[model samples]
Target: MFLRRAVYYWQLIAALLLPLWLFVGWGIWGGGAWTFVGVVVAAPVLFIAILVVTLIIYGRSEVRAANAVSWLDVALLALWHLSIIGLGCFGATGSLFAMLTVVTGLAAFWGTLWQLVRGFTRRARQTLREFEQLAGQTPPRGHVSSPEQGDVYVVYESRDQRRA
Candidate 1:
């Protein structure tokens, strides 16, 4: 199930990344030589940093399963794309680029949001499981009546009978 869902999102991620890189390249190509340099150099560097972090985290067995990253981690990523959009928006000197920037940023934002939510939910579930384990055995006492306690009976003695 994990791999199945990962594959589906991987496709969506590819779609999102390809267009984003293309847009950055386009922005740089049209913007200026410096902008090209920035995109070319920055993109690979950022990608490598992310790759390294991912490796470091997943490489550890314990950390890999119960992953937890800060909101800043998410924001930094969002900002990376947003910066590109900002570049295209402000530098492109055209409406098309600006619109693409907005759309791409919005898409990326939603994607990040989805991942954050999923990650948090996963963490919550893991924590719940851990707590349950720590809670130990159930209480021995319960409301259910035990059969060994003895039967209920009404005792009747004849009033007129003399003491036995």
Candidate 2:
């Protein structure tokens, strides 16, 4: 249980930190002074932007939901972060390995983005369904009317609402 919770929290932490780590590590390893300086300057700005977007989208409760991060997220994080570190170690040289690393990193990025979009769409649909259900229960204020003596209404309903 403890391990699971740790991994769950780590996923969120990694999402926040991995990009900065990769950029700074690569810049330093590649021995480009300007690259290092640029990444250092950009890291906090990028982190802040991502943090704001995340908070706006997920909110605090959603962000803290138990088991919110799955194994797939951890796997993708590992794949992308490791690929980035590999790219750094390879000195940005144009080689097959470097290309493969770039592809892996990109795949991980797209996969994570796809998951986020799908989750958001699913949540939106659920909320819409709930809103529709609520709306169905209440009549319009100006159009409200009580049942009249001659009004026809169903006397009994089955759980499935199918007549036998």
Candidate 3:
């Protein structure tokens, strides 16, 4: 169960990181003119392709169960990808554009972080509530009760007999 929840969180993180990784890679290695041009052209197309594919997959009824893509995922993808493109465009100029790009990048980062934290908090609260419910239903150890008798009884039998 914990692993399943973690997978959902990972999906969100992956969406945020995809564009970030591309941006950072381009910044670090986009020295050649052709490389820069390739990235500038390819990135938006790639983003569009992925967006369409994800939407199509999520739209299908049969795929819905396996693909747990939410609107949050789509929003994160768009926000981060746009931020990356904006940063690439504005980062070269040491002016207001650069400042704006930095602000946008930081805002995207903070927004993603906030979403992750909120998700974790919600999941924790849900787990705690479930635990409380299960604990309430559980009877005390070595004790048994009969609905017909309307009485509580303690069993002094050995563990083996109790199992039987």
The lDDT of each candidate is 0.50, 0.56, 0.53
What C-alpha lDDT, on a 0 to 100 scale, does residue 158 get in candidate 1?
60
Off by over 4 Å in 3: 1-80, 83-94, 144-164
Please, what are the lDDT tens digits per residue for candidate 2 over residues 69-161? 445555654565465455445364524544665566556556656666777788899999999999998655445355663444434544865
lDDT for model 1 = 0.50
Task: Give the best candidate by TM-score.
Answer: 2
Comparing 1 with 3 on lDDT, the higher-scoring candidate is: 3
Error of 2 at 151 (Å): 24
User: Candidate 2 regions off by >4 Å?
Assistant: 1-64, 91-94, 140-164
What digit string (tens of lDDT, one per residue) describes model 1 on residues 75-103?
Answer: 44445445544554434454555455445
Mark the regions of model 1 whose C-alpha exceeds 4 Å error after superposition: 1-29, 60-63, 66-76, 79-81, 84-164
Q: In terms of TM-score, how similar is model 1 to the real structure? A: 0.33
Q: Could you give me the TM-score of model 3 versus the true structure?
A: 0.41
Among all candidates shown, the one with the greatest lDDT: 2
Q: For every model shown, what is its TM-score relative to the native structure? A: 0.33, 0.50, 0.41
Worst 10 residues of 3 by lDDT: 54-63
| Worst window of 10 by summed lDDT in candidate 2 | 53-62
